[model samples]
Target chain A: MADTQRPLSPHLQVYRWQVQMVSSILHRATGIALAVGSLLVVCGLLHLAAGEESFNYFKSLIGSPVGLVLLVGWSWALFYHLCNGIRHLVQDVGLGYGIPQFVRSSWLSVAGSIVLTVLVWAYVLTPGGAA
Target chain B: MSAKDVVVKDRRNPLKVARGLGSSQSGVGHWWTQRLTAVALVLLGVWFVVTVLCLLHADYATARATVAKPWNALLLIAFVLTMFWHAVLGLQVVIEDYVHVRWKEVVLLVAIKFLAVLGALASVLAVLRIALTP
Candidate 1:
C-alpha cells in the first residue's frame, strides 16, 4: 500500500509487444511452472526410493490422465526454458543485439523448443528403446 | 610487498580496484554453473523425455525396467540431483531479490533447501534400489 498517492504514469500498456518481450515473459512464466513441477519429481523419487510397492503407487499416479496432462505441460515448459536459456546465454556474449537478430533469435528459441520436444516424443514412441 | 601493492594501486583509481570487492557478482561462476547444468539438462532432459515417452504406452514392468537400466538409472539420478540443485540456486536469487519480509523469506529459503535435498536424495536412492536389486 502506497502512503502517498499519485496518478500512476501510463505503463506497459503503451509499448508494442515484441518477440523478445514475449520470450522474456514466457521464460519467467515457464520457470515458475517448472518450479512447481519439481514437486512431482520429488514425489517420483520418494516413491522410487521407498520400495517397489510405494514406487508402484507413484507410477500409477503419474500414469493417470491428470498426471499425463501435467507431465505434458511440464515437458513443454522445460523444453521452452532450455531453448530460451541457451539463447540468453548466446546474447550474454554480445551476439544477437541487432533488432532483426533479436527478433529472429526469439523465433529460433521457440521453434527449437518445439522441434526438440517433437524429436524427443518421436524417439520415445518408437517401438524398441525404452518401450 | 608495500612497493608492489603501491605500484598496483597507483596504476588505477583506488575506486576501480575497490569496486570489485563489493557484491557486484563479476565472476562467471554462477552464470557458468547455470549454463553448464542447462547444457547437461538438454541431453538429460531429452533422454528423460524419451524414456518417459516410451513408458507412456508400456505396462508397469516395462516402465520399471526402462528406469532400471544402467544408463537410464545413472542419468536419471544425475538429472534429478543437478536439476534440484540448479533450482535452489535460481530460487535463492529470486527470493533474495524480492521477499522483503525477512523472517518469512528466511523460512521459505530454508524450506526450499530442505525440499530440494529431500527430493534429490529420494530420487537417487530410488534409482539405485531399482537398478541394483534386479
Candidate 2:
C-alpha cells in the first residue's frame, strides 16, 4: 500500500481560509466539545441527588479556576454550535443558497455566537448573577 | 426473446447486492431525527440556561428543591434525553466521516453510544431520585 502513491483530493491545506470554512469547521468542533461537556451535566445531576455535601463539593469544583475556564469554553462552544446549527437548518430548508447570502449567513453565525456568548458572561459576572 | 437469452447472469438477487452497498434505509431516519432533536434542544437549552441562572447562589437545599419541582424535573429529564440523543447522532456522523480505520471507527462508534446511553440513564435516574425524594 505504501509503494503506490495516489493523488488525493484537496483538503484543508489546499483551500484558502474563509468564513464559510471556519463556520463549518467550528460547528463540528463545538459539537464534539459539547458532546464531551454532556458528562458534566451528568455529574452535576448525580451530585445533586447524592447529598448536600456532595452537591457543595460539585459546586466548588466547577467554581474553581480550571473548571471556570472550561465552563467558559463550553458556554462559547454551545452558543457557536447553536447559531451555526440554526444556519444549517435554514439551509436545509433551501434558503440562503446564493453566494452572497451564503457568505453573509456564515458571518452572521460567527457574530451572533460571539454576541450571545458575551451577553451570557456579562450576566454571569454582574452582581447577583450566577456563575 | 428466447427464455435462455433473457437469463440473468448474476445468481444473487438485486436486493442482496444492494443490501450492504448502499443506505440501509436508516440514513434518512438518522438525519431526520438529528434535526428533530436539534429543534427540541433549542427550546430545552434556553430553558435550562434560564433555570440555572435563576438558581444563582442558591444553597444546596434551594437548588435541590428547585430541581425537585414537577415542571423542573420533567424538563430536566427531557433535556437530558434529547441532548444525549442529539449528541450521539452528531458524534456518529463525525466518527463515520473521519475515522478511516475500520476497527477503530467501529470501536469509537460503539463506545460513544454506550457512553451516551449510560450518561442519559444516569442523569434521568438522578433527576428521578431528586424529584421522588422529599
Candidate 3:
C-alpha cells in the first residue's frame, strides 16, 4: 500500500490557454520577482542611511546598464502585479465573478499594466524628467 | 448476533477529515489578512513609487531631506511594513503550492517569515536613522 501509485490530477498541459490562467500565473510569478526586488529597496535604504558616499555608490550601481535592465523588468513586474492585484481585490469583494467579466478584467489587468509601465518609463527617460 | 449487528467502531482516516475543509480552522483569517494588506499596499506602493521617482534626479542631501519630512517618513515606514506583510502572505502560498516535500515546505515557510521580519526591522531602522539625522 505504501508503494501504491495514485492518479494525478489534470495539469496545465490539458487546458487551453486563457487570459484568466495567464493572469493567475503571472500574479505568482511577479510576486516572486517583487520579493527579490524588495531586497534592492532595503539596500537603497541602508546605503542612503550610511552617508552621501555610500548613497552615491548605490546610485551608480543602479544607474549601470545591467542595473537599468533589471530595474526595467522590476518596474514592469510591479505594475503588472499591482494591476492584477486590484482585479483580485475586486473579485474578493464579490464583483467580476462572471466568466465574461473575469476574462475582461484579466485582459484589462494586462493592458493596464503595460500602459502604466510605458508611462512610467517615458517619464523616466525624458530629459529633466523624473525617473 | 450477526457480524453486521456487532458494535464495531469505524475508524476514519485523519486526512479525510480535512479533505474538503481548511485544516488550520482559522476560517478565512489568512485570506482576509492577504486582502487587507493588499489594499494597504496599493495606496502605500503608489506613494512609494512616486517618492522614489522624485528622488531620481535629487542629490544626496536633497534625497535625505525629502525622506526626513515628517509625512514622508511616516508613510515610508507604513509602506515598508505593509509591503513586507503582503509579500510574506503571497510567498507563503507560492511555497505551499510548489514545495511538496513536507520538511522543505516547513523550512521555507519559516525561513520567509524570519527574512521578512529582519527585512522589516532593518528598513524601519534605516528610515528612522534617515529621518532623525541632521
Evaluated with TM-score, which candidate comes out highest?
2
Query: TM-score, chain B only, every model?
Result: 0.77, 0.86, 0.84
Model 2 C-alpha lDDT versus the unseen true structure: 0.92
In order, the Cα lDDT scores of the candidates are 0.77, 0.92, 0.90
What digit string (tens of lDDT, one per residue) describes model 2 on residues B1-134? Answer: 78886796788888888895547868988999999999999999989988987887889999999999999999999999999999999999988877766788999999999999999999999999999999
Model 1 docking grade: acceptable
Q: Which 10-residue span in candidate 1 chain A carries the lowest summed lDDT?
A: A1-10
lDDT of 2 at A63: 94
Off by over 4 Å in 3: A1-10, B1-21
Q: Find the 10 residues in a row with the least total lDDT in model 2 chain B.
A: B16-25
Put down candidate 1 lDDT per residue, A1-131, tens digits, no spaces: 12336433333577698788889878877877887798787677566656668878887887688986777678778889988988887887889999999999999989988887777666655666544
Each model's Cα RMSD: 7.8, 4.5, 3.5
Worst 10 residues of 3 chain B by lDDT: B18-27
lDDT of 1 at A61: 86
Q: Rank the candidates by lDDT, best first.
A: 2, 3, 1
Error of 2 at B75 (Å): 0.7
How do the residues A15-55 of candidate 3 rate in per-residue lDDT, one tens digit apiece? 89988999999999999999989999999999999999999
Cα deviation of A72 in candidate 3 (Å)?
0.8
Give the residue spans of candidate 1 off by over 4 A: A1-16, A49-56, A114-131, B1-27
TM-score order, best first, reads 2, 3, 1
Tens digits of per-residue lDDT, candidate 2, A4-104, equal 35533237877999999999999999999999999999999999999999999999999999999999999999999988888999999999999999999
